[model samples]
Each structure stands twice: as structure tokens, then as C-alpha cells.
Target: MSNIIKTIDVTDSLENLKDVCDIENGRIAGKIFYDQAIYEQELEKIFARCWLFVAHESQIPNTGDYVTTTMGEDEVIVIRQKDGGIKVFLNACPHRGNKVCFAESGTTRGFICNYHGWSFNVQGNLVGQHESGIYEASDFDKAKWGLKEVAQVDSWKGLVFATFDPQAPTLQEYLGPMTWYLDALFDNQEGGTEFVGGCIRSTYDCNWKIAAENFVGDILHAGWTHDSAARAMLGGSVAKVSDFEESYSVNWNGHGYEFALDTVGNVAVLGESALNKYLHTIKPSVAERLGEFRSNMIGAVSSCTIFPNFSFLAGQNTVRVWQPRGPNKIELFTWVVVNKSAPQEIKEKWRKGAMMTFSPTGVFEMDDGENWEYCTKTAKGRVTAAQDLYIGLGMNSRASDTSLPGNVFKGQLNEANARAYYQQWFDHLNAKSWKELPNRNFGKQEAE
Candidate 1:
């Protein structure tokens, strides 16, 4: 409790912005979605400083395989090395800041700048400049002119993440207890997971946090927002409006997941029978490896967000990164992840299932985008921006001691995870350094 108090200051506006979220009271200021200053601050304090998902190892398996992505606002290249290590570098050329990698993804021995013919190797070392010895007299060195590299890059279960802050904790340490839940999906099978379907991208006229928070623990909206999609696809067997047995898990660094225990097979709207059969086939192995709790999550429809802006749906097998474009806009990149060792039939089914449910034109995806767009649009109004949004559901409920991780709330219909998320966001925005950040536990008494 003392640690929590030290991190928050509701009355302070030292940086020309009010405390947009009050985690202790479960109130979020609407202006957070529409304010430019807050958005810029988030880009600096959250996106630049925190670990962000770049690409999965499966996406770039071979040497020289690469993917272009954004780490905060800077474009970067995530490339594989000959030594079996991963490296990330600024996509811009050192000479004139022109982008060197133009393709979205492909295997190439090296990248050449189209603007001036400057070239860099797979390791990001400048190999060929347009003119050799042009600046030799000026102490120009190709060794010091390679593409700028990210301070840190690491992978966890094939998921690649990069950070600009060298002082930031390792990926595993930053992920903390969230890894327990992630492994349940990523490492459930013997061969682990791989990104299968080609990426689906779309833009939303809403703040990126809106989408991230929704995936984090907003099951409250599924019953209404996605009701039609569920009914149209599953004939009313999925996303029911009735109460269901569910649980919520939150981690120290703001990562969270919400899952329903009873709606396992019913959640996979595409080829439910086939998917269910497959789950049963793999259940024994998964249970033996990850224990009963995770094995039981095989077919359960669950949504999770990895802190800042990476999110995914477990049952649908869709993973996404919400790339922030501005205070009220985002370009969403999505992919379907599947068990690497799954039968071709199972992988195809999961791929098609993700396309049907969570793709850009997906029934559920469109509905969610509409809601978030309007939510952001409304917040632009002066009256709407000043109102406090209530997120107090299950705030006062007792924390359940569980073998899972973080603060485990007993039911899924709780805002406990969202509250913890905003608390972490607030703490990040206020902290001057990583060492100054507080160890926030949201008042949970038990320790893992």
C-alpha cells in the first residue's frame, strides 16, 4: 500500500497534464485518449522505454530473414544473423536518414538504400556506400556509420521483443508472472508455436490504448458488442450474454488475461468439432507438460495484452500489435499463431478461424473497431473529455490466492486487471528512471 501511494499523485500536473487515470479509484479520464501531450509522453515513457513485440522467430527463421517494424515511432529492421542471433536496427540509412529496407519482409543477403545506393549487410554493418573514399579525408568511417541498433533485443518462446532502453530489465523479468499464462498458449505443444497466416493490417480512428485495454480484460463488451458476430458464426453457442465461470489474471508489469473456463470448445467458432477433437488429442501431452490448469485452457476463448500495445486471442489464434499513429489513431498489424507441430489440417483450420473472427474484415473485428472509433471521437469533445470513466467492476473484491500469477481475481467480470494496467501506465509516466518505478501489487496480500 505504501508503495502504491508513493507512485500516484492525483493532484499533480507538473507536466501540463492532469492525472488521466486514478487506479486507486478505478476512474480513467476521458482526455487520455484525445490529448496530444499525453500521447507524446506515452511514446517516450512507455513505448520507447518498455519492451515491445517486434516479430516472432518463426517469421524470420533463416539467415538474412527480416521484418520491418516500428519500435515506438522509429522504423526498425528485425533481422537474423549467421550466428543464429537476432539483431534490430533503425531502418534509416546513416548518411541521410532515408529508409534502407523497403520491403515488408523477405530473405535478403543485405539491404540497399534506394535513395543513394548505400548498402548494409545482414548484420547492419555498412558494406557499400554509393562512393568509396569520398570522405576519407574527413575521417569518415563506415564502421561508425552502420544503421543505429536498438539497445536490447531478446526472445521468449519464439516471440521477439526489442527495447530502446539498455537499462530496462530482461524480457523474462519484464514479463514476470505473465509468462506462466503465455506459455500455456505459446508452449502448450511439444514443438512450440509459430506465426502462420500472413499478417492482416488495418487502421483504426482511435487511441491505441483503447484497443490494447479492450483485449486486456474487456469481456464485458463481448456479450453486446460482438453478439451478432458470435450468433452469426456459432448460432448462439458462443459469446453468450449469460453469466459464465471465468477467471482473471494480472501481472506486475500491467500484462493481463481473461479466460472463461466453461466455454472451451464452444469458443472456437470455426470447425468447432474438429478443433475440439484436436484439443482432446493434445490435452494429455499439454497437461503433462504445463499442468492441469493450462491444459484445460486448450479450447477456451481468452484475450491478452502484453503491457503497452501487443494483444492476442488464444482460441482464435490471432495476435496483433497496435501501432500508435497519433493521439487518436493506430495502424493495427495482426497475425495468426499456431502450434508448429500441429497437423497441417489443424494449422489451416486455426488460420482460417482467425481470418473469420479477428481479421480486418472479421465480424468481431469490425464491431470492435466501430466501438473504439466512436469512443475516441466522443472524447474529443470538451464535455466528454472532462468526464471520468468508471472502471470499478470487482475493484473491492478479495484477491484469490492461486498458483497462476500476479493478482488473481476470482471472476472474469472484474476490472482488477484493467486497474492494475492503468496503475502501471501511470507509474511509468511519472517515474524519472526505471529505478524510481514502484513495485505495484494492487494491494494483493499473497505472494507467488
Candidate 2:
């Protein structure tokens, strides 16, 4: 309910975050993209509280399998236990606060701290150290010195997520209505999906919000920014930027998807003819499982973001996590996804195809880094950072239909989703807890 920005005090800045985006009117303050206090609040309120992607279940199918990842900026080790359950532990050693495991991923019986040899098992219990009897009489209970564990770890389909806040909602509830669209990416095959091979990590000199918001509704940029990549791919490796009349932007809570509902347009551009053919064979099945609307989404020309920082290109076969580094920087982790039951050759094609377009050095990926970086860099200008950006393009473009899920907008070019996303960003920073966030049953709503 507050709207003013006059101080750098943490409390004042957080209070003013509500002023950063005016969803009702379609306007946003530029500083929300690079403000330090805002970023600090996000690390605590949003990243720590919301469910965040860690690793795919495929990455750790057996006991002791593990992957090192970050929830917000806090490094964590997400590992499978002997019971075939996953647990996420803070990677910092309790002994001296040094990193326990440095490897990005691997299978192991336990983790040994490199600094002091303080070791912990997959369950995060402190097992031993260099000397066994050194602290026995010193009131040091080894049982109390285990690595900090996340309060929650869960998965939907094959994607794993974790959260540090004990009061955070279940991952299923956090995902909210986004599940309808997620099924298109995840539930396409009988065996579900898994990430193919290793992920690609790269950094962008931009705020995490800037990159996340881009995927929320910036498909309009497709026609202009990525045209060259589309041309260079010889038109077959990327879908044509479609006319506004054929596309849609839909959001639920803060999660959003923008797509041209041309079913095979997404995979067709991967430059894998057989992959396209394969998807065609299953299109009927997808339609039957999810109905005609989401069936068209299985391989459509689309980009989506699940609130906070996780995003993926529906047709491009790339999944991304925009990890925040600081107010002015973000680390991007990219992965190619394929059906768990897919043919090995088809999975390989997805891997290579995703690499060709979204890897660190891929054609489409190269075109976006600088643009995002510059957006963050330029916002440093004192005057520029204070201005309000006009996001009113689709202020009245709402689509009222009970058939489609989420807050649907009529066109992909609209800024409705971006506005909704920023509003959620504001709400998270301003709320006392997750319980204070908005909750409205969305049905028969319009996008305008």
C-alpha cells in the first residue's frame, strides 16, 4: 500500500518496492532491475521462500548421486539418500564454513570438507573429522554440527526444487496453475522427461529479474532481436515470428507462457527433421492426454517462465535457471530436456539441437547476452534508473474464457505477463510472509 523511494535503508527500500511496478496501469520503475536493497529482499523473501529448481531426478537416480547447485546465492548439495529420497543441504561445512564439495555433480558415499576434513554422509549427518576424540569432552555434540538442510525438497515430473523457508508452501501449490502448461513440457511421454546430459552454465551481466521477466512475455522481441539467428539458421532451425493474431500470452500467479500455437513450429526449427517427425507421431497422444489446447503447445513456438527465475523455450528444448549473482549480474544454467522414454538417437538430437540454439555459444544465445547485460549496465545512469517504463501495450487485451487456464491475453506481443510478473515481484518483497500474497481463482478472466 506504500509507494515512495527516498532512502537506501533496507526497511525503506523494501517498503518502496511496491512502487516499482504498477500492474493496474502497466508501468514499472527501472531501478527494480538493479537496486541492491531490492535484490537483498529477493534473496530472502523470494529465493529463500519460493520453491527453486535444483536438479532433475534424472541427475540422481541412485543412492549417493548428487549435484551442487544454488538456491538464490546459497550453494547447496542436492543428493539422493540411501532410501531413494532427495535431500538438499547447505554445501558449507559447519566446522569452518568452507565448501564441502566442489564438484558440479557425481556419485559419492559422503562429502569431505577440503579445508578441515570434516565429513558428512548423504543424509547430512556429521560423521567424522581428522581426529575422532578431539572434542568429546568439550560439550561439542557432533549431532548438532551437521550441515544445514533445506526445509523442503520436492519434484514435479522430473524437475526437482527446494526451499529454505520452513513455512513455504508445498512445491505443488507454489507451481499453482502453471501445471497446465508444464504438462506440455514434462508429460509428453509415458515415462515423463529428464534432462539430457550435463547443463551449460554461463553468466549474464544483468539483474536476474531482467532476464526472468524477458521470458515472461517478451516474445515480441522474437520478431526483431532474433530475426538474424532465425535467418542464419536458414529458417528451418527457428520458427518464424508469427503475426500477433495467432499468438497468446497467459499467466497464472506470476508464472507465464507466450506462444504461437503452431504445434510443430518449435521442434521443426531444431533442425532435426526426425525429431519433428517423431513429435508428429505423438501429437495425437498429447492431444488426447491434455486436450487440444495444450496438445498444440507440446512443440509450439513458445517461451515460458515459472515465477522467480526458472524458464524454458518450449520448442527450443532448453531449460534455464537465471541465478542471481548481485543486483547487476546473473548466472545462467542451461540444459536440454528430452522424454525419459525417448530413443537414444532422438535424445542425442535434442541435446545437439538445443546446444546449437541455446548453449553458451549457441546462435540464439549469443544474441541475447549483450542485450540483457546492457540493459542492466545502462540502468546505472542516475536519471535513467528513476524513470517509469511504459508497459501498457496490452492493458486492455484480457481474454475472458474459462476453457484456457491462467490469466490469458489475446496476443503474444502484449506486456500483460511482464506486468503480472513484476507485480508478483513487488508483492513478494512487500509481503510479511507467503500467506499475505494474492490468491484468486482465475476463471473467465480477460487479459486487458
Query: Could you estimate the TM-score for every candidate?
Result: 0.93, 0.93
Q: Pick by lDDT: which candidate is best?
A: 2
lDDT of 2 by residue, 1-448 (tens): 1111111222433565546677787788778777787788888778877789999999999999999999899999999999889999888988788999999999999999998788898888888988767777676788878888887889999899988777777887777667878899899778888888698999888889888888988977776787777766655444445553477888877888988778777677667888888788888988888887778888888889988999998867899999999999988999888888878999999899888888888887877887888888877887888788888888888886556767888888789889888877877777767667665333323323
Range of the 10 consecutive residues with the lowest summed lDDT in candidate 2: 1-10
lDDT of each: 0.80, 0.81
**RMSD in angstroms between candidate 1 and the native structure over all alpha carbons:** 5.2
Please estimate how well model 2 matches the true structure, expressed as its whole-model Cα lDDT.
0.81
Question: Between which residue pairs do clashes occur in model 2?
Answer: 237-269, 395-448, 396-448, 397-448, 398-446, 398-447, 398-448, 399-446, 399-447
Candidate 1 C-alpha lDDT tens digits along 307-411: 999998876778899999998999999998889898898888888887778887888889999999999999999989988999898866746555656667767
Residue 418 lDDT (model 1) = 86
What pairs collide in candidate 1? none
What TM-score does candidate 2 get on C-alpha atoms? 0.93
Q: What's model 1's TM-score? A: 0.93
Model 2 misplaced regions, further than 4 Å: 1-15, 236-246, 439-448
